[model samples]
Every structure is written in C-alpha cells, then in structure tokens.
Target chain A: MAKGGVAAERRRPHSHLREATVGYAFILPALVGIVALYLFPLIKTAYLSFTKTGVFGDSTFIGGANYANLVTDPTFGTALRSSAIYTVIVLLAIPISIVIAALIAQVRHGATLYRIAYFLPVVTLPVAVGMVWRFIYNGDFGLLNALLSLIGIDGKAWVADPTVAIFAVSAVGIWTSLGTAIIILGAGLQGIPQDLYEAASLDGAGPLRQFRSITLPLLTPSIFFVSVLSVIGSLQMFDLIYVMIGRNNPALSQSQTIVYLFYQKAFVEGNRGYGAAIAIALLLIIMALTAIQFRLQKRWVFYG
Target chain B: MGNTQPRHHQIIIHAVLGIGAVIMVAPFIWQILTTFKTVTESRAVPPTILPAVWSIAAYERFFTSVPLWSLLGMSLGVLVVRVGGQLVLCSLAAYGFARFRFPGRGLLFGVFLVMLMAPSQLFLISQFDLMKSLHLLDTLPAIAIPGMFSAFGTFLMRQAFIAIPKEFEEAARLDGANSWQLFWRILLPMTGPTLAALGVLTSLYSWNDLLWPLIVASNKHMTLPVGLSLLQGQYGTDYPTLMAGSLIASLPLIIVFVILQRQFFAGIASSGLKG
Candidate 1:
C-alpha cells in the first residue's frame, strides 16, 4: 500500500496517500492484537462448540450433541434461571443509584466524599469484596444477624439458604455498582442546563415535577448506558458468587450463574466442548438482549 | 443547582447522604477491625465491632501461610505492562482513526465497537487454548498478554483525539512536522488528563482482575486476587486471618485510588457517557 501510495502521489500530488500509509502503520499493532486475541478466539469458540473435546484438548466433530445436552441438562436450566433472576434483580441498583446521584447533585456539600465512599466497592477486588460480605453473612456469628438482633428480629444464614442466597448476593451487587451508576448519572445531571430548571421553577414546577419533566428525559442516555452495562455484567457474574458461595455451599446449585457453570464444566470437569457451547450460548444471549435494548432505546432514550 | 436548596432541605439531604456513606464504607471498616481480632473473637456471638484484645496473630499467620510479597509483585508486574501497552497502542490506534482518512476506516472502527460490546468470556476457551498451544499457561505473560490491548481503550482515546481541534494538526503539518512528530510533541503532551484517566482505569482493571489470572496461573505465579482466593479455600472459617489477607491484598489499590480519585472518577464517567 505504501509503495502504491508513493507511486500514486507522484502523479496526483495528493497528501492523503502519505497520511493513509501512516495511518495503516499506526493501527497495525492494534489490528493484529484484536484479530489474534478477539476475532480468532471468538470464531474458534463457535467452532469448538460443535465438537467433542478429549482429555488432551483434541476435539472431534460431535454435531449437535453438546447443544442437545445443554437443553436437557437440569443444571443448565438452573443456571439460566439464576442468571435471569440475578440480572433482573441487580437492575434495582439503577433507580437507587439515580436517586443517590440526584441527591448528591442537589446537595451543596460533601459530594466528593459521597462519591468516594460509594465507589470504594467498585475499586476493591471482587474476591476481597466477596470475602468481606461472606463474613458479614456468616450464620453463626455474622454481622447481619447481630444487626437484626438489635432490631429484635431473627436473621437466618443469608448465603447458606438457597431461597434467599441469590437475593442476598444481588443486594451486594447493588451496593458495589451503586457508585458507578451514580457517577454516570451525576455526569448526565451536570450536562442538563440549569436554566431549564430555573425556567420551570418560574412556572411553578416543584422539585418532583422538575425532576420528572426535565431530569428523567435528559438523563435517559446515561441511564440506558448504565442499565445495558449492568445487565451484561450481571449476566456474566462469577467472581462474587464463586468467592461468596463456596463449592460446598447448599445454595451453590441454585445460585450458580452460566459463567460459573462454564468454569465448572470446562476447568473442573474438563468438558471443553460443552463449556465452549455454554460460552456461545451466553454470547448469543448477550447479543440478543443488547440488540433488544438498542431496538427499544428509540422509544425512550431521549437524544437531546 | 449548587447551593440553591433551602436550609431545611439541605439538612435532609445531608442526613440521607451521611447514612448512605456509612453503609457504603461499613464493609471496609469491618474488614479492618476484623483483621485485628482473634479467630475466637471473630466468631463470637453478636460479633464484636472492636476486639477486646487486639492481636497481630492473624497478620502473622497470613504472611507465613501465603507468599504475599511475591503475589503482589506478580500483580504489579502485570499491571505495569498492561497499562503501558494500552497507553501506547490505544493512543496510536485512536490517533490513526481520528486523524487519517483511509479506506475501511469506518469498518475497522465498527469492529472495535462490536468487540467492546461482546463479553470477555466469549474468548475464554480459545484464549486458554492459545496460551496452552504457545506453552504460556501458568505464566505471567499468559495472564497479561490478552489484557494488554483493549477495544474500550482505543475507543476512548479516539474520542479524546477527535475532541482536539484539527487546526493544531494542520498548523503542525504546515510547520514541517511529520505525523509521529506532531503526535509526540503536540497532541500527546496535551492529553495528560486523558492519559492519566486511562492509566488509572487500566491499572485498576489489571490489579483487580480475578478470572483470567485464576485460569492462567496457580501457586507461585498467582496474582493477588487469585492468591487470596486460594487463601480463602485453604483457611475456610478463619475469618480474622482471611480478612487480614484481604486487607493486605487490597491496600495498594486503595492507596492508588486515593491518590488518583479524580482521574478514576473522570475516566469512568467519560467512558459511560461516550460508550
């Protein structure tokens, strides 16, 4: 291309030829990295899902056996259900975070402090975060039970009980993600012109009316961004659950996500082909959900 | 909207925010206090907020049981390389996308955006296989190589470069500066905030990453989070010792966050807005 560009430049006297050569050179590293790591692996995963992998990682074409097994597997059903429940439940963080962002934006003092405090969870290692929360949820001598006792209420083992374990973990999800949602929404809030609010006030709009009319509409873009990311992150949830609910936990079967199942099948059981199929399933799910969100965005995501 | 609230409203806001702040920070405080307690004290009913007799036994046990310093060294090594690679590669790619008019530019950029949207788990099996084929499994490079380049980083840097006026580049070109010269001397220096933000984000991700490292390394090569996970599995109910290990593992990143809080927040906010 550079050689052709040099030859063309002599006849056309165009600077674009030189710039294009430089541009290609500049992007070469990134292009190579992306293709080698991302694109190839993506295609390879898709291909591997159709085969059976041996103990030594040698694969043979198995047709639809893996997918057939995935559909019939009870564990896969539980993982899918848990993933859906976890994703839906964790989205509660969005509205709560929006309220926090609004409150922080309204206050004249200590905004930075609030942001720092809330963001602490986001920056901490998930393993560490899970461990700390696990200690707090311990049934025998947990902080949650102690706190409940102070209010004259009984608290069962939060993460040990399958019925409440997913919800308990989802609550931690909300706590950890609240900081990020707030920061994004806070930036969105700042983007809204104050004159709009002042104008609304002159026409007798109260805080609630002003918020409903102006803030919610203008903030929809950030809200959409946060919600989409939250959903994706929740669907792929593994680190927190793996650490908080151990392999022996009674709730493990009920609360394990698709990724956790993938890890178990691929690494623990050495079923690489089956794991690849699960990963592809997750990828397709993510794409479909993301596509649906994009399709629905036009209805509610206010561009202006 | 700043300082426009009535006095009574201000009080209400402060009260609500204060309570929220306490809830947010309570875990870290609990972890620290737990680190100093005895195992028996940690398991005491009504779980004492402060130990009756503070002890250093947990810390001693943690250090002796785990290769703490080596794990930290491994994590830091990965972080430095990952951050440095992303800074250079992402900036170069972003500059190319922002400044040049080339065939397939739109197509390549679209590819980057799609890559960003796809979950990292999609690449897990193949990435592991790649590492295995290259004989790089259970090594630091296996852990760091895949993370060294990021679609999100490229997109971010491209946006930052695009935000810069074209006039500067045109002026530099007229002054006989080449593309590399202009990028190095003019545009790069001016992108201090953007670079800092990227650096903070890349470092945070590399330091806190668990899954990739867990899959790629074991024992001696393990990074902090992976090593800490092993510690949890081995020590099961030793809450005090586990908390000690957790606190020690998290301290460096917390310190980095404290020092670069503004850049961290700005990076996350901008990514959300532009993404």
Candidate 2:
C-alpha cells in the first residue's frame, strides 16, 4: 500500500496521494497492533484447533480428535443447552425493555429519572455488579432470602441450585442489559412518526391497537438488532458466573456455558489445544447464528 | 391531538414507567442498604432494609483493608491518559477517512472496520504476550496502551465528520488552511455532540473495564474493579465490606452518568446502530 501510494504520487504528483499517505501513517499504529494481537491470535486459534498441542507450546498433529471428542462430550452437551437457555431468556427480556421504552417515551414526567435508574446497572462495573449480586443471592443471609422471608417464602440457595442457577444468572444478565436495550428501543421509538398515532386514532383504533399496528412493525429493526446482540453476548457468557458462582460451586458443573467451559479448558486447565477447539466451535456457532439472523431479517425487519 | 384521549394516555404512561422505575431501582437500593448494615445485621433473619443501628463500620473497614484510594487513582489515571490519547488519534483518523481522498484509503479504513467486529477476547493471549515482551507486565500502561486506539470511536467520529457539510472544509481550504488547521478549526468545532458522546463513552469504558486490566495488571496497577474482586476473595462471605467496596467503586460511574446522561444514550445508540 505504501509502495502503491508512493509510486502513484511519483507519476501523478497529486495532493491526494500525500494526504492519503499521511492518513495511513496516522492509522498505522492501531492497525499494526490489531493485526498482530487480534487477527493473528484468531487465525492461530483456528489453526491450533486442528493440531494436538500437549501444552501451550509443545505440539503434534492429530487432526479431528479433539473436535470429535467435542461432539460427544456430555459436558459440551450440557453447556450447549445452558447457553441456549440463557440466550432465549435474555432475548425474552428485550421485548420487556422495549415495552418499558415505549412507556417511558409516552410519559413526559421524569422520563430521564426512569432512564437513569435503569441505566445505573449498565454503567456499574461488571465485577462490582457481580460481587454485589452474588451477595444478594447468598443462601443464608442473602437479601433474596430475606426478602422472601417477609412473605413466608423459602428462598433456597438461588445460584447453588442446579435447576435454578442458570436462570438466576440469566436474571442478572437481564438486569444489566436493560439499560442498553431501553436506550436503543427508546431511540427507535422516537424515530416513529407522530402522525401514525394521530391517524390511527382518527380511524377509531384504540391505544393498544395503534401500538400493535404502528409501533411494533416500525421497531422491528432495532428489536432484531437487540436480539442478535443479546444472542451473541449470551452465548459468550462468562464473567458473572465466574465471579458469582465460585470455581468450586456445585452449580458450576451443571450450569457452565460453552465460553465458560472454554475458559476453563484454555486458561485454568492449560489444555490450550482442547480449549482452542472449543473456542473455534463457539466461533462457528456465533457465525452460523449471525448469518441466519441476517438471512431472516428480510422476513421481518422494517427499514423505517 | 385532542386533550381527552391524550390525557387518558398520559395516565397509562406514568403507571407503566413508574413500575419500570421501581424494578430498575430495587437492586441498587438493596446494595446501598446492605453497605450500611453490619455483617450480622445484614444477615438477620428478617432482612432489614435499613440497619437497626446505622454505622460506618463497613465503609471504615473497606477503606482500611483495601487500597481503595490507590485503586481509585489507578482508574482515574488510566481513564485520563487513554481517553486523551484516543480522542486525539481517533478523531484524526476519522477525519482522514471522512474528508480526504487518499490512495488505498478504502483498504486502510477497512482494517479498522474489521477490527471493530473482533471481540476483545480474541486478543487476550497475544496482547498479554506483547505486554510481557515489552516488560510492562504489571504496569498501568499495559491497559492504557491497548485502549489508546478504538475502532468504534474512530468509526463513529468519521460518520459524524462526514455528516458535516463539505463546503465548510472547502471554505477553509480556499483560505489556504492546511489539513491540520481544517481539522482543528473547522471540523473539530462542528462535531461537538459526536465528540461529547465519544468522550463520555470512552471514559466510562476505561473506568469500568475489568477483563484487560485483570489480565494485564499483575499487582502493582490494580484498578478499582480488579481491586474490588480481590476484596471479595479476601473477605470471604462478608457482604457488608463487599457492598461498601462495590458502592465506592460505582460512585464515579454514577456521577459521570448523571452529569452526561443524555450524551451517553446518544453515543450508545449511534455507535450501536452504526457499528
């Protein structure tokens, strides 16, 4: 590129070449860092998944063994199920946030106050959020139990129960994500035409009818975007579970997401090759899901 | 547009928003209340919303035990340095892409866009290796250096700059203003909202960041998030202390959001939609 730019400048003697060369020079550092650090590792992960590396460095060729094991691994099956559940649950919350955004958009009084309250969790550091929420879920004196006790309800160890742990974690995911979803949905709602509502009313459509006919169709693009992002993010869920549920937590074995399993194999266990396989598998899942969403968007997402 | 139906709709609107507000504010209220309670008080059978005896014991203990001040300093230090560098460099690159007709421009900017799609997890190992090789393993710069350039910021800024009327830049060019002067005098001033949104977003990310700082800063440069995590470990099962630390760590973000709430949403929506 530098050669091409310099060569073109010599022939044409144009100011555009000088300007472009300078632009490239300024962007060079970030480009170099990203290529070396991000893209290289991504490619390397893909390559390493194909080979058999005993340690992080020592290597041998054993094509498809790790991936074949990944196919039948019971843990992988469980993790996949858990990841799917988390994604579905989190995706469900998007509509709830959209409804909330719609309601907030209609109200003139203290709308910013509602936004701030919701966004507080979004802005809080994930580590801190994890810690605080972990304490709230504690079995004995945890706030959830205490709150339940008020109504004579027994709140078991929410995050320790295998049946409920993933859901518990999903609840936090829903909470933290509410702010971004609300803000995005609110922006989408504002893009909707005011005349649509007025016209619907003149035609004798009720409020709910107006929203169903007017708002829902127009908001589909943002809704689709939020769903796509939520799925991608939920599949990669790790930080909160890692922090809230201890490494030794019994629920960890039952509720592990694929990315959490990948972190375990790659970072903690130092089975870098197997971990790389899991990472690559997870990448394939993301790519497939994203491709499908883009394909399906034609059926649903409205541009306006 | 008549008053009756519009007024009736207003009642439903408030009721709905009111419920949403309660749900959103509940957990934070719980967190704040827990911070003030004693370990025993927090664990009481009928969980107390407000402490029976109000005390600063938890807050006092957190400050004394953890290097809360140093962690705060680290968060601020990384935020100030990285945000300053990123604002300058990202805006420059954004303007270059938006205005200048340069050779290989499409290919160069394509790299930035591609990098935007790549998640931070992909770079964890290589970035660690880079920092280790540079002998910056346990330093603040390890975190700040990677954060100094953001693809999203550059992409958003370029869009903002492109939205500026080309005639403004052309007028500056007609007056013999150089490229730098055009960017500084004409372009920068015109994109105030974009810059505000970028600044707030960048600062918030840097301030609340955990993953990279966790990987990069060994012990010496422990930021607030990392420090708070360690606090959770050390004070095993101590809710009050953890709550207090979490509260303190959250204060900066809350203050920043309150002051710049409008810009934060604007920035997030624009960047999310575009990127």
Candidate 3:
C-alpha cells in the first residue's frame, strides 16, 4: 500500500501498492466490525469454555470443567429440553406458512390485506408481543379463558403453569415467524410459472392435483429453506421467553431456553466459563442441525 | 391465469384465510383496545368488546411510570448510528470487493461469510467483555456498536455492486473520478434499492433488539424494547399500562413500515431468500 493519489503514484512509484491501499481503505471499516464482533469473540468463546474464573475475575485454565459441570447441571438440562421442544414445535410454521402462501397466491383480490395481517406480528416488537400474550394468558380474566368459556371448555394459566409455559412461548415463536415464511414461500409460489398451473389445468388437473404436481415440488426449496432458518431462529429464542416468562414466573424453570440460560449463567450468575461452554454447545448443535438439513435437502429440495 | 378456482372453493379459501387473518392480528387489536380501557373494564371476565369509557388513564400512568421520552430517544439514537454506519461501511466494503483484485480478498470475504452465518449468541459474551474493558458498559454506543456493521448487509451490497456493468466504472475512471467519488456520486446512487432495503432492515433490527440492550444497558441508556421488558416485569399485572406502553414503543416502527411497506417486504424477502 502506498500513500499517494493514482496520478501522483503513476508519475512516482508503487502504483499497484497505492491501488491496494485504496482497496483496503474501502473495506477497513467493515473489516474492523467483523473482527471486533465475530472473529475475536469466536476464538475467545472457545477458549473461555475450557476455563474457570476465580473470585477476582481472573480465569484459570481448568479444561473441560465447565463442560463437565454443564452435563450435570439441572437448569442447563431443562433449558436444553425446552429449546429442543421449541425447535420441533416451531417447525410446524413451515406447513402452515405453505398453506397460507398457497391460499394467498390463488386470491386475485385482498391479497395484500391478508399479507399485511399475517405479517404484522412479525414486525411488532417481541417485548410487546410477549406482554400482550402474557395478559391474554391470565388465568382469571384472560382472553383465552374468555374465548374458551363460550364453548364451556376451561383454559388454565397458559403461561403460568410450568407444564404449559414452553408450549405457550412456542406458539408465539411460531406466530412471529409465520410472516417471514409466508413472504418467502409466497415469492417461491410466484416464481412457479403461471403456465405450469395453466398447462396442468389444460391436462385436466384439478386444483389439488395441480398443487401436488406443480406447486409442491417447485416450492420445496423455499420449504426447506424456511424450515432450516426457523429451526436456527427457534433455537436462539430469548426475548419472548425473557419477557413472557420472567424470573418470578413459576414456569421460568420449565420454560428456560438455552440462550436464556446462557444469559443467566454468564451475566446474572457471573459464571462466564459455564456460559461460554453453553454457547459453544449451542453452536455445535446448530452446525449439526444444518449439516443434517443439507443432507435431507437432497431428498426434497428441488434445486431446479 | 386459466384456473380461477371453483366458486365454492374461493368461498372456502376466503373463509379460512379470513379467520386466520383475524387470529394473526388479534393480539394487536386487543393491545389497542386494552390501551384505551379502564382498568376494571380491561380485566372484565366476559371482556368488554369496547371500553365503556375510552380513556387515556393507562397512558397517563405509563408516561408517569416509565421514562418513555428518553427511551424513545435512545432507541432512535441507536437506530440512526447503526443503520447509517452499516449502509456507508457495508457498501464501501462491498464496492471494494466487487472492483478490487487485492490479495486476501477471497480470504477476507470468506471470513465475512463466516460471520454472517454465525448467530449473535456466539459473540455476546465477548462483546460485553469488550465494552467493559473500554469502560463503555451501560452506554448507548454499547447497545449500538456491534450492529453498526453487519455481514448480511455487506454481502447484499456486494452482490448489488457486482451487478453493475463494468463499463460504468471505466467511464467514471476516464473522468478521473477517485474511488470515493465513484462510490459516492456514480455507483452509490445506482444502489438505491439495496441501500434502502438494508436501511429498513437495519432500523427494524436495531429497534426491536432486546437481548443485547437488555444485557448491556440499564435504566440510563435503555432502549425501547429493554425498557418495555422491564415495564412488564415490574408492572406485572397492569395490562392496560403495559399495553399502552407497548403500543407507544411500537407505533414509530409500525408507521415507518406502513410508509415503506415495499422496502420492508423487500428487505424481509432478501433475508429469507439468502438463507
């Protein structure tokens, strides 16, 4: 890298160097961000996972102690279980979104209305979503209970009961994500050429028949994509749980997602080493899932 | 176009979709209704469809209880720096990667991709530590810094930049336009959609971000979401006030989204497609 303008450098020396310098200058700001946020932390998290911190806030190399401790830690276990449950449950969004996207695609009128309605929750702040849902789940005066009362069915404290809390949170998770999946799948639906359906129709294929033959196979890529992203996003779920099932809630223990546990251990409990270990474990799980997804994509995701 | 569904089928589709749409926006509708209800009416067992007395009592309580003004200010502050920084820096980097044949370009861009794929949790603990060491804990910048640039934005801008024909760059260069001038005046202007999409996405993310600000900032530097979360925690059973606060915090983004629905949808589509 040189320190002159292109004209000056052409008349002088190191013109190639000056060009490289300018190129580097252009990327320097973003490079600083990647390093500061990603690269540095990645290596640090890996290292800290293997260490323990003293009372003085200094870390000692106690290899695998944090990892071994996590194996027996009950809260970690609960968080892991809840997170897995959430991931599995939210995967339902894929099929739901597909149906909605298909339905929206067929409509010639009021399509944007449906899109806006479905997508509104996705844009609303999660804290707000959590709060409103919490209020809706109130045992005595909640909306859910009120709605159930009309049918003579009883509704329990949806977010208050330990047994039902994670499911409650999972519902919100699925709700927030439907909009993104619908948008993506809707785009995928549009990309399925109109003539494919028209051609199928000329061949006497009914709507259901045409859908199975033309729409399903072509939209598999988006389906596969939305599922993978949904799972990844679901595993990292925090805000809704944090707001809806706060510390004082009886269901907090049962509803703790892995990331919630990570925040608690690292910051609230001052167990950075264990928290780092949990984070690494989550990273590994995500990688394994992605690998599994790619392997499975071959079976269904039509690249064409 | 040849196949409009049968009449009965269209009726059924609309019926199902209509119900689903209602379910989707039900909470928001409730939030708005609850915001204006009296405390007693808001909690009615049968639930009043509308408040017998539409009131701003909850708003008064919320404004008095929470630092709504400052929270909004901090969130806006974070959003501005984050979105502005990402657009400028990401486009510059993307432009460089698009145009330059520098050594390590492949390696560095690969690194950016890795960062792009790595989720936020991987970086949280360390980012917090970095902020601590710099004595920046509980600062607005602490909330805003990590998101000031993003791998997603860079990659998106890079793709947009690469799609620009090479002849334009050669033409600009023949005019003796420097790299800055080329990016600022010529090439940058051409990337309007990409820039707009990234800006909208960045602002939305920054505004709704909870975990980072929840961890990093306390009362003084608290962003809107974090503040709202705390409001929920402290005012646990106060549905009216909570809904009121939530509506106020969410209104700005909702308004912006309504105005820039195209950009919002485009931004969301790009992100999901990139996956």
TM-score of chain A of each: 0.94, 0.91, 0.93
Q: Write the per-residue lDDT of candidate 1 for residues B32-101, one digit (tens) a residue.
A: 9998999999999978778999899999999999998889999999999899999999999999999888
Please give me the DockQ of candidate 2 compared with the native complex: 0.51
Q: Score the docking of each candidate (DockQ).
A: 0.68, 0.51, 0.66
lDDT of each residue in B1-275, candidate 3, tens digit only: 24566688878889999999999988899999999998888888799988898999999999999988899999999999999899988999999898877789899999999888776888988998898888898888898888887888999999999999989989989999988899899999999998998998888888888999988897578999989988877777878999999999988998888778888888887776231
TM-score of chain B of each: 0.96, 0.95, 0.94
Tell me the native contact fraction for each prediction: 0.73, 0.51, 0.69
- Candidate 1 deviant stretches above 4 angstroms: A1-16, B273-275
DockQ of candidate 3 compared with the true complex: 0.66
Candidate 2 residue pairs that clash: none
Candidate 3 to truth, TM: 0.95
CAPRI classification of candidate 2: medium
Kindly list the per-residue Cα lDDT of model 1 for residues A188-215, writing each as its tens digit.
9999999999888888888889889999
Query: In model 3, how large is the Cα lDDT of residue B6?
Result: 68
Name the candidate that leads on TM-score.
1
After superposition of all CA atoms, the RMSD between model 1 and the true structure is 3.1
Question: Per-residue error at B235 for model 2, in Å?
Answer: 1.5
- In model 3, what is the error at residue B194, expressed in angstroms? 1.3
